[model samples]
Target: MGLLRKAARAMLSLSLATRPAVADTEIDKHSVDVAATARAFAQAAPLAIGDSYDYAPGVQGEADAEGRIGDTDFKLRLFGAWDAQDEERRYADIRQASLHWRHDRLSLGAGVGTFFWGVSESINVVNVLNQADLRQAVDSKEKMGQTFVSLGLRFGNGELSLFYLPTFREREFPERPAFGLPVSQRALFETPDKGGDIALRGLFYAGDLEAGLGYFKGTRRSPLLIRRSPTATEWTPFYIETENLLLDALYLLHEATLKLEAKTGRELDQGFFAANVGIEYPVYSLPGGIQELSLIAEYLVDDRGERAETLGQNDLFIGLRTSFGDIGNSSFRGVVSYDFDSQGNYLDLGLEHRLSDYFRFETRALVFLNAGRDDNWLYPVRNEDFIEFKLHYSF
Candidate 1:
């Protein structure tokens, strides 16, 4: 980690020194934020495979640097994690190393970056830019950076952006099986190695309404696992070409917000559609300036139903978040996702509070109910419920 930090600082210094300075611009305005976190987990039940451990521990470090030279801005971010129990869980990623320049209404950028699309919290059907970092968590929030070139033009009420991705990143997986599944073998791509994916997006704002339309033609970020042989137990990831159209919108009403995200696409020879609609309402200064409460609900639907590889198919997600306005800046969140047909559900509880200027702590518990049901995605890890604690320090 020390070497990594030094190398990143050296690279940033070299880049800044080579850039042309501007008289009116703050060329020396550069800052780096680094954080180190340690985590420990306590499993309610033993894992179905491997050592069947009831406890595990891990540590991770992250660094983000941002700066500007004249009219161009640059950013660099790095992350790495280590796990004692699973070798595959120990990995590193250059989540972002990109540069952008803008003049008038035109903007251009190139390098490794992360792009996210969608409005719903439960399921982001339209987010297909970067590969998932499954080793980090199952929430699908963490992603690997993608190499690409992007161009954008701003309009009076909206903007149009085009992305040309010249490369693809394979999804990350852990060595130990979690959801009652076998460890997959190497990945196999149906398209050429030099993935030439393209995406175009248009976003418009009208008063309280915001909407976006997007299209993508590229190698799918999620893979279809196929058995190696009829009798083999191993599976291999097969990346397929896909063409997808996506729509997302948000409307603000009083203290409530409406969110919707939908996608229709063709992968290989199969056609599918998925949609998610959600609403969030927040009450500020609950009981007079001590706390705030937010209510959230969302419904997810997928045409593929049982055949869908992801979660949130015919499911309802309900969440409650509470913020205690105090010096420590404490917060509490609870979410439940219930599958309508399979009678399966998931529960997550999280709490976090700041300890000091440079330290913070968080704890989360995940519970799977009716996970053994045949039609439930959690059937793979019926006994994988666990609680995790994390401590973080920022510098």
Candidate 2:
């Protein structure tokens, strides 16, 4: 309690000391902006209803406040959402609430924040800082906010960052009736103590080539399921379950990135290494520079071979992205992924267009093909193909 109180006092003092200076500078510069952004949507399927499908509806609201005071910058964003699918779907969270102080070669940040540190189109193997909010999206693009203190220093042509995460958050999953795991046998998370994780990363860029190396030691954001009993079968006939089935495994991760957006990483004690080697290059441009098309290809591999869940042990992902550089700022992206070991494949398509300055429209579809019992993680969701549309309004 004493340490926590001291930390709180320090944070409060830091904020108070810089508040007035920032306000005066902003008033002089006449550059202050505060606003709110929000999105609401309803999701359904075009096919007839089935025992495994449910109509999911949700809405998200957020407010952001940002300003600069002299050499310090502060931003606070509050996010909340509600989903009609289940009771656990409704949540209120701090998306980003942080103060950033910068010097000539040093930068410091504190409070809850979010950051991504990977270079992959289909998956992010090196980004392990924040847990995914899977209920919002299964693509792993959306992440929950993490509270931490960060320090970054620039030396020569490289930058080094150190982070201290004071708490750990678990990944969010959708209800069983949805496309993910069943809710009947929910996972039991092993919560961690305060200040349970530390991370370090160094990044360097040279000409057209860039590279990064990172190390993380802490409780895993993803949980591993363990059977409570050898013969328990209430969760599913294929697998056993226990009362305390969710186990949070502690791990050390070492990752590296190279040019062409290649990423490789290994988890200590996991006995496997994973790699995503890919390149994203623009194919051509349309006439008058109104549109552009880009090609993407990546080979994914896991040393665990065919026994891995979630990610296929050996796979290929090919995608195309088209951007309409018009007033509406429309874009379309699609990807097809195939697993060599199980002969399973999936397709993902997404489209987005702006209706007005304050409104936008988006749609996405996920389709599974040739998925069978041999597939590790995709077999349960093979029959859950669906399309989703959303209209977003921001101001």
Candidate 3:
């Protein structure tokens, strides 16, 4: 691996230093990024799930490169991860590979890429362009790439964009049953395998406020779990045809920021609504050389309430972020989420520090509280609290 990286760097430098002049096409600029991480979890596997080690080890790597030449630009990214305990967790993905062209107010792009479309931090109900990569994490924030052709028209204060996606990626899961329920490997889709989707969005910017309006019609990224047969003990993912209207906005107010994201959609032939509203307020110059402290709070609401298919239904999330302003760039974040209906709570704590110029260290802890009731979504994993540590190297 070291030899390959050295060769790649030498070739890139040689190509840039010894390029031939061509038809007035300016060889603009290029950049490359590579990183790797070693991680471990200090948690024991539940006997009900399977036999596993008291500690789990994992590794991850990613590389990205981008360049711009004249009126066209291109980007590529690759990522892979492997864990010792689960075969399903060992996989690689092409997160992005695309070419984009722009002239005046019009722009076009083609290829596979990942897209993000929400302003809230806790949860984003409007981000549906790419499929979720659940094997990597349970937050549903990670995503797989999608093949698409996109066009955009820029105006005075806004841009109108349209996307035509030609492919769909299925969700991934662990071999062991999640929450002690059996899950099948096969997935069902309402549309044909190749039947793609379409989306349109308009973004506007004015002073301290940023807002967007979006519409999507196609396969639902979030699937409904259904029994494969009447008597079967296993469940399969079922992706249904759906349509959604999305709204997201951010407004700056002095030392604080206001964020709002809301979506109303039709999935599984039923209408649903969800929203997240939050605020971020920062206080500078605390005691004991503390550089800053940020307070984050958000409220999550879903019309389905306790029967929602996912977590964060009628819950409140509060977080505190501390920056030390030290040479190692140390920071810490702590969060607590409380379920209003179930009276359950979740706690998360994270700390990060740069060990050296090329190395970084991070640690995180997750705990569940008052989740003994089976009706609560977190009940199955209530005893699955764990702490994780990671070391990252980048160049």
Candidate 4:
């Protein structure tokens, strides 16, 4: 680790001298702190065994089964497949680490090891949000100060936060853009990634419900970026980083959203201002498990704008997922959503089972039928399939 730091500093010195000089825009103090943070996380992790350990290794895997019989989360499943494109990939990730602390209402965390970065393709845009990407910040595990910090705070129902986070909300592959956006859960976003800016959020109670509103500069204050120009046209393609400056507000009336996972699909990069609002209502109650359900919906609207990539059409859809049990955890989940004036419809089902106290399995499948008849806006449509067999380990 020490050697890597020396090499990185040597490399940075040479690179910094070549950049066009903008003293006012220089990153002197910030760079120093970033370097320090990276170094601190790379030092070897202490194991309970002993201090004499040299090398360490581990593996992760999942397997599942389904027969259209629903228990808690799925209504129906045609078939389940192992090594499915959606579940497992070639290069499964190895190790991960994070220096996170949460006490009272204040929280601070930063990761320094390689881990998971969610997908960004067509079908996944609505479901996948930002996760973690430590490898993108490091020159190597040995390079100290190779990671980034995320500081978050909560004052009552309101909160403030900042960090160099990567969010691949919407993506379009120039070549073969129709693929269910094959993304490996194990890979990190490309290096030299970007971060978010000053964000403020507040909460309140209305009648018998809870809700909130929030906004952030997105990237308005980012030092490395000066302007945001997203073009939504067929010839060019306006790609908004989803990390840009914009306003996002939500008011979720909480009730029966327990143990439920829903999905929606659309694009929201660049000038697209996306917003989501939701409320859940409990329908029934039982003995072993309580039968509960919730409804949800979200939208992304991009008014007439520059034509650089895709058509500036509004995308609106709604979905629902429900589970049953005394703890609000059921073995079944069902979802259905529709798109208007553009493409087709979507249906997704999921089921979970407890094989034993130490073993469990989950099954999931999704179908994206012909949603777009003409597809002038490139609304993707195909009989896409996915399944998951997850085995979890608890301490």
Candidate 5:
């Protein structure tokens, strides 16, 4: 009967067989429609047991490649000029071939392929060095497998899970990447089972909160930190990770992470912790039904001064998400973050577009600006720029 109500019905007419009516003064039909759409989406989305891949091969023209290593043999501008002439490119092989299968109570997944791993990083320093860059110095392709066996207990509100990771390969530790490693070590990039290793991730959940703890005791040396200073070039850090997350739709959520590692040479023990808490609100609509808004603020601490002294002093990132119209998942989101007392200041802008039930594409650009001269900047003094582009697909 009203103009706005008619608009919502018009939009729903395209998909729903009948426009569900709402109690004029009790609840909004739009909220009902939104909730219905969410349920439909959750039911139609691709299952966890599926195969997919991504190729994020790009270039980093000039990244202070010659700053501390060999400044004389190569002038700073030479690397910059080389970048201008021919930048470095990477072929991630996002994934190789993989298979998935899921039943009412159990699910399994395995693959021998290309995948991008979020190497355990010191959260304090947001740009200490990318995990890809770290692994690039050792191994290229990492074989990955995961299994989820859940049993609905506690009146269908609680579940349990188990995960596994096998020993893959090591990175090509070039004497000095300035030159490059020999063909022998580079060949190890694709090797599998050359060593023995196993990792376990156990999770327990109920209602809106969950707790998880994991351990990795492997022989393969995949140290997340490698220090190469003139005074002491040490290879310390084997592997370690500790993390947890709590998620809720209508109330509140909290997430936290802490990592510890012991290296081969220095035998240094390093770690850091990050925690965040947020609020959520559920809203019903005038046309369909369920809609919601969420806000979160995160804080991180890095105590890896023994390894990468320039890792992180402190870090914070906040995000806001909203859903509307006939959309199923979140239709739009915006984020703001402040980090790096070293390289000056950094900001990120991102956008996500859903193509279908099995595919999605997203692009984000980060800009770095030197806030001031030397001592004033909390980060390193590198006039470098970083940009990341990615696409996700589930079969």
Candidate 6:
């Protein structure tokens, strides 16, 4: 880790000396857009046997604006969602508000933004720049914007990026009464008090292969839960009403990618290593005009062993995607992830079809299989299988 830090500093110093001059040419443009969605969700199983079925209705609105002014670019995005069944699920957030400046091979950015890194299908162990927005989804596919200042330098066949994150963001969670973990199990979150975080990443492209290496030193976005009350009783198989659980932890991450991906992180007290290797291939034009079918497979492994909580220790993810290259630009995707250690599995299916230039229809379903007590992450929400339908309109 010390060597990594020294290397990052050296790269930064070298890049600073080679900063390119800004161009005098001016190109300014700006546009604003808004989107709204109405969604409905239905649970596949009762929270309790004989209990009433759970249903939820939700609506979301998003506003976005972006433009370029000379050598600088700016973007802003805001989102709000309302859920009738879950108060915790109803929230508003500033997804992005950032400005970027580029001069030849050098680029710099600041403000709140979101970044996705890594090449894994089911999990993103190497992508930690933003906090997970669990209020929207438990799959970790959604991310909250993070405030940071970043600098990037492009040289040779690679680019190096340095980030100084000045603020820490915590992961959002579903309300205590939600189908997932109970409120009592909620961790007591504390904001970090000292200097924030620092991260560095280098990405290189060679032939048809792309690779990246990343390092992060600072607070962990995901908190670790510590039982506060030892005598709390379980009210249901899925819900436990414990008084308060302390959730605080920090860690360092070292990740590398080679067409495939690998990651390792160390908490203040413990550490774990993880990896994912996958391939994606597409078959063009089946009977339909300009249609394509894509196949994907990724194997995941984590060395946290039985103690792993959020991530599956060992799993395989297989996915298929179909693109109907018609006027509507419709698509369908399905993924099945199986945990080798616990023999538990889940399937995710999604379909999206553009009805017109201004409207679209989408639906998603998550189904769990054999997610029993032996399962690490899925055991808590074993019965919360659900399907959601949504209609979105943009203007």
lDDT per residue as tens, model 1, 95-136: 887767777998877767888888876678888888888887
What does each candidate score in C-alpha RMSD?
4.3, 7.5, 6.1, 17.3, 20.2, 8.9
lDDT of each: 0.75, 0.61, 0.73, 0.32, 0.31, 0.64
Candidate 1 RMSD to the correct structure: 4.3
On residues 1-395, what C-alpha lDDT tens digit does candidate 2 reach at each position?
44334335545655675563634444222122222222222233222223323455667667777766576776766777676554555777676767778789999877777788767778666677787776665556778878778899998888999988876665655552243334333445433243458888888766545567777766656545444577643232112111111111111122222222233333433444666677677755356545778787877776654333244558899999887856529999999999988889888899988877778778887777668687765775565566776777777
Cα-based TM-score, every candidate: 0.88, 0.78, 0.85, 0.48, 0.44, 0.79
Clashes of each: 3, 4, 0, 36, 41, 0
Poorest stretch of ten by lDDT in candidate 2: 240-249
lDDT of each residue in 180-280, candidate 6, tens digit only: 33434334543325226788888876655567778887666655544455654322212111111111111112222223666666654566676777666
Q: Report the poorest 10 consecutive residues by lDDT, candidate 5.
A: 31-40
Question: TM-score of model 2 relative to the true fold?
Answer: 0.78
Evaluate residue 44 in candidate 6 and report its C-alpha lDDT on the 0 to 100 scale.
37
Among these predictions, the greatest TM-score belongs to 1
Worst 10 residues of 3 by lDDT: 2-11
Which has the higher TM-score value, candidate number 1 or candidate number 2?
1
Tens digit per residue, CA lDDT, model 5, 120-147: 2222211111123321221122232111
Candidate 4 on 1-395: residue-level lDDT in tens? Answer: 44234334433443343332333232211100000010111122232112312122222332222121111110111111122121221222212223334557766544332221111111221221232211221101111122334566777645665544322222212111122232222222223233332333344444543333333333221011112224311222222323323222223335433121112222233244332323334455434554555454544343422221222134454555566555544567665545555555555566766555555555555555455645433343242223333444422
Cand. 4 TM to true fold: 0.48
Candidate with top lDDT is 1
